[model samples]
Target chain A: MTAYTATVTVRLKRGVLDPEAETTQQALERLGFELSDLRSADRFEVDLDAADADEAADRADEMAERLLANPTIHDYEVAVAER
Target chain B: MTAYTATVTVRLKRGVLDPEAETTQQALERLGFELSDLRSADRFEVDLDAADADEAADRADEMAERLLANPTIHDYEVAVAER
Candidate 1:
């Protein structure tokens, strides 16, 4: 088995209300930073033993689908790299 | 000005306690997934008009320093791309 680090990025689907991002944008503007838009995402990195990169990615994808992301509102992507 | 998207990824400093990541790892294990370690991060994507990629990255870096991350315990990276 090879050690791989899988990165799962979960993002809110378009058209969803992102209150946290909105609040962050306002805070940045208050600090004199100009930004037209902002979005926030959650990233999870899992280090595991797998036969190959594809196997690691598949595990991470399942993790995202089952727990990391809510299918109703979030979209996610998974990528894997050698440790 | 050109439109750019700045992606700021904030991660916990090494040795920092990450309860969320630990919990996530345990949850995955319970679901019959095997993982050695896990970590979590926050990614903020900021869209704005800027003179160039450098300017956009600078703004995003400031955002991460001031609000997106806690310098005392977090590390962050900013990447800018054309929209």
Candidate 2:
């Protein structure tokens, strides 16, 4: 098995209420920064051994679907790389 | 000014304590999944207008440093693309 890093990014789906992002956007505006809109997401990087990158991504996808994200409100993506 | 989207990824600095990541890792273990290490980050996508992509990226970097990330414990990156 080869060492791999699986990255899972979880974000609230469109139309989902994201108070955190709203608060952040407000903070940026308070700081005199210019921007139109802001959204936030969570990223998880898992290190493990797998047969290959595809297998690693599969495992990571399973991980995200099961625990890393809330399907009703969130969308997630997975990427894999050598460790 | 042109429309642009900025992505900022905030992550805990190396050696920083990440209770959230630890908790997520534990949950994965409870589910009988195997892994070595787990790390978590936050990603922000901002949509706005800029003179160019470089200007957008620069503004996003400033956003990360000033409000999006805690410089003491977090590190952030910025990427910009035409919107």
Candidate 3:
């Protein structure tokens, strides 16, 4: 088994109500940063022992879709760190 | 300024009290996964117009330290996407 670290980010698609993201964007603007089209995302990190990178990525993606995120309204991506 | 995307991950150092991580670890174990030393991490995605990649990374690291995380018990790293 190979030890791998996975970082998963879940975000509401555009036109979703992201109060937290909106609040942060407002705060950033108040802090004098002109940013537009701001969106909020949540991240999860997991360490797993899988047979290979492909296995780890597949399992992480499945976990994201099944438990980590609500795919009907949210989108997710997994970034696996090199071992 | 250069438009770039930044992904920041904030994680508690080992031995910190991470109740959420513990809970998730337990859940994963119960789901037939034997895992140990589980730590939790948070991810943030930011879009910034910086002068360069280094500037963007620096600003992101600063933001993660100053606002996004409590550095006393947490460590953060930033990954910038190639534009």
Candidate 4:
């Protein structure tokens, strides 16, 4: 089995009222940051002991779908770190 | 100014009771994931109009310190995407 690290990001849908995100955006703008697009997401770093990269990804995806995110209001993506 | 993309990740310090992070970790373990360290953080994707990489990074760090994170409870790191 190979050890892999997965970084998962979960974000609310565009229309969702993410107060935290909104506040951050406003704060950034106030700090003289000129941004074209600003999006906020939640990140998770999971160290996985899996059979391989594929298995790690599969398990991470499953975890995101089942528990890490609220499917109706949030979306998620997983990035596996290269060894 | 150059256009740059920055990804900032903010997380609560260790031992902070992150309900979301805890739940995610538990779910992963249940799904047969063996992990050494699992941390939860918040991610932001910002498209910045800056003079260059250094400027963008400087602005990003300022944003993170002043607004994107609560210094007492949360810490943040910024990653600049290469164009």
- Quote the TM-score that chain A achieves in each candidate: 0.98, 0.97, 0.87, 0.84
Using Cα atoms, each model's DockQ against the true complex is 0.94, 0.90, 0.47, 0.67
Candidate 1 lDDT over residue span B39-74, tens digit each: 999999999999999988888888888899999999
**Candidate 4 residue-wise lDDT, B10-69, digit = tens:** 889877888876676777778766676678887888888887788888878888887888
Each candidate: fraction of true contacts kept?
Answer: 0.98, 0.95, 0.35, 0.89
Error of model 2, residue A35, in angstroms:
0.9
Span of ten consecutive residues with least summed lDDT in model 1 chain B? B57-66
For model 2, residues B1-83, the per-residue Cα lDDT tens digits are 89999999999999999998999999999998999999999899999898889989998999888888899999888888887
lDDT by residue for model 4 (A1-81), tens: 777888888998878888876776777777776777778887888888777788888878887887788899998899887
Runs off by more than 4 Å, candidate 1: none
How far residue A51's Cα lies from its native spot in candidate 2, in Å, is 0.2
The TM-score leader among the candidates is: 1
Candidate with more favorable, higher DockQ: 1 or 2: 1
> Which candidate model has the greater DockQ, 1 or 4?
1
Cα error, residue A48 of model 4, in Å, equals 2.0
Candidate 3 has a TM-score of: 0.80
Error of 2 at A52 (Å): 0.9
Instruction: Give the worst 10-residue stretch by lDDT in candidate 1 chain A.
Output: A54-63
